[model samples]
Target: MDSGQISIGQIRRSEHLPARIAAQLAAQITEGHLKPGERLPTEHSLSKTLGVSRSVVREAIAQLRNEGLVETRQGVGAFVSEKCARPIRIKDEELGDPQSFRALFQLRVPLEIEAAGLAALHHTAEDLARIDEALAGMTGAEKWTHQGVEADLLFHRAVAEATQNEYFAMFVGFIAERISHAIDAARARAVLEEIVEVTIAEHVVLRDAIASRDPKRARQAMRTHLLGAASRINLSLEEF
Candidate 1:
């Protein structure tokens, strides 16, 4: 039972605790701090060291396992996979910084614009319905709360799904999840009523463009909405 000297520090309570823990462990594995075939510290040990519950440690390990970074042998323990391939990820800290946050939006803009265009060409009635439902949720959400953020994400995801491309949906979901905290932070800093009203209005325009089957207008509308969103957060995406 060699619990190697893994230097994981105690984590503060946060909404993304499991993800934060997973990212730290992934970094260690990728940097060769944790060797291939080396067993990870026991869940109990990790919980104690990280100052989190065992369930949190378990969830973190599950995330690593899903990424092919760890293997769990029932009755034995979790070990680093023999061939550890690094997976693409956006670190939580990156979203907290202005430059990295802007960079991520730079990546998001083009993909979402293209998705909007394709969705305009391909979306079914059901897709439109889902988009409408999410929009309605956003309209009714309490100011700057988690519910508002979730509804906003759902709208984007619905549009991505309307593109009829699984990969678009997957990537949109990934990017949205990674940047959600930033979105929340931005909303918290802005005039709540004004931001909410302006955001929902932009979403309406984009939605109508897609529903009308106007691909060009849909793309332009999406571009406008995204740019406006950045502006609301006090981020200038004009040069990007």
Candidate 2:
């Protein structure tokens, strides 16, 4: 091979290697392989171990720093930030009380309702395609599980992405797991089966409203759907 020419494989591998290494290190932090406040290895050491260039290691560290996972001291090495290792835990005690859960639902309703409305106005064709794909997944009744819950969440996430707002997308992703947990908990109660059906049907309505670009209808439908869910969950909680 000529020194002036780049191999296709080299280019492809170069593109992927740094990100792969960064992600692996990040997983170590998030998964507790690297404890909070532990210093990272020097760039030279990390590069040798990961089989990447020193520049690649440096860039990876920069990315982690941006995510608040690591920090640097000018004369010293990089250290794991305390914020990086902890997972956000929504405790059983939080859900044990009806009032707290209701309050949570109250806060969630408006954020999503507004997001849906904005999505109807701003969604791209590709975003619509993603939404449709998730909807199709949900229609397969035999396949509904935690994965199904995720697909359902993805449909809403697609809408948030469609809104062309970064903060909305980030906020939606942040709440996605918590909302899924709460819904899954509620759904486990046999009394909430009807509520599940209603919820899926409302997703259909919400999807159609957004597809039609009817922002007002989309927002109102989402709000109504969520409020209805709150009511049913509350009723089941009362029984519990």
Candidate 3:
């Protein structure tokens, strides 16, 4: 596999090939292989190259469209979507150390609490509906794996959206996703192993508080959740 290009095998193993392919390709664009307005390879060509059926390739392309990562020209091939330079990848190490795992929780506490507070204070009816939709998605997800994390993320993202600030929403979503990914990889530790359920329940607190539109309660709920998670980390941090 060329490190520069997304691999075909990777797509085949993807749980949601279409969406995953779209996100990967979009990342490539942000990372700079596909330039703005550059025509994507034809569906047939991509299908053959990626070893996926043409239908899969088309579906992936459609997923990219939803993300504003590509555009379809009537007679021409799909082109890389505009606003391609938006930097969305959030590296786990940014919170400073997966081994300790404490840093990740520490990083999440304050930022997310504040985001929740702001969201409650500013959210619109549409934003609340989005949160409700995300919450509804959490019902007995066969297992707390990929789907759980995605639904968890959707709930938090709705809070950010409620803030009505683009930067807040984008950065919060980016950081939360990275933090969640790191938490997922910490399965060897019992404390960290429960982080998914911990996170999901904590999110429900924020969601309910936000839905109530009481900023103070929302902030308090978020803060308490973060602090609880922070205390779970085995590592001690002097700064926090």
Candidate 4:
């Protein structure tokens, strides 16, 4: 592998294309395959090499820059930052571990609980519409499919957005993205029809609470939904 030269096989097609690409390049940089101050392959070069669009490559590079892993100069391409102090992050692969998954859930619960409360207090009609749309998506999706998982994520994001706090939205989005694969895995293990029905019902309750503009009710509803999710995943929160 030439200095920042990635092969087509290195990239995977998914809804999170930019993130997946960023993770791959970040691994290379941290593993020393790409040296400090070395220029990354140009966006055009990376696009062709990885068989992805320039926009995808640009977004991946932007993520790296945000993490202090890369730098860019005007009229020049991006280069690995000399002092690449990568920020704290939960690697996607680590979520497969039960302990890591549980820890992530622990972190998620309080943030989302507050988010639900704030959303109830602050949500606009448009916010409610987004939540409803996501709910409808989940309600209509086929059992145990990625579509359902994505819709579930969107619903949480909608709630986060309804809080009208950008940081709340950002962190909630991050946590939701991290737990997505775990949710998918749990869905696979669960009894399909039962899980689908149960999960949808919980979301509906949460949505109604939010729509009703009752912060207390919304917080409780979110808590119940998250705990129910943990149970479906075979995790005992009592042990934590």
What TM-score against the true fold does each predicted structure earn?
A: 0.68, 0.60, 0.64, 0.72
lDDT of 3 by residue, 1-240 (tens): 233255434465645555556666766777778878788888877776666778777767754653456778888878886774344343333445544355555665677778888898889999999998887675455335556656666777788789988667656665565555444444335553366667667778888889888889998888876665555544444443
In terms of TM-score, which candidate is stronger, 3 or 4? 4
Between 1 and 2, whose TM-score is larger? 1
Worst 10-residue lDDT window for candidate 1 reads 82-91
Which residue window of length 10 is worst by lDDT in model 3?
A: 84-93
Clashes (N, CA, C under 3 Å) per candidate: 0, 0, 0, 0
lDDT of 2: 0.69
lDDT of 2 at 33: 71
Query: Residue by residue across 40-157, what tens digits does model 2's lDDT show?
Result: 8888767656666787677567546544567789989898889734334343357557776666566667778899999999999999999898887766673246556667767777
lDDT of each: 0.82, 0.69, 0.66, 0.81
In terms of lDDT, which candidate is stronger, 3 or 4? Answer: 4
Worst 10 residues of 2 by lDDT: 1-10
Where does model 1 exceed 4 Å of error?
1-87, 141-144, 238-240
Best by TM-score: 4
Clashing pairs in 2: none
**In terms of TM-score, which candidate is stronger, 2 or 3?**
3
Best candidate according to lDDT: 1
What is the TM-score of candidate 4? 0.72
Clashes of 3: 0
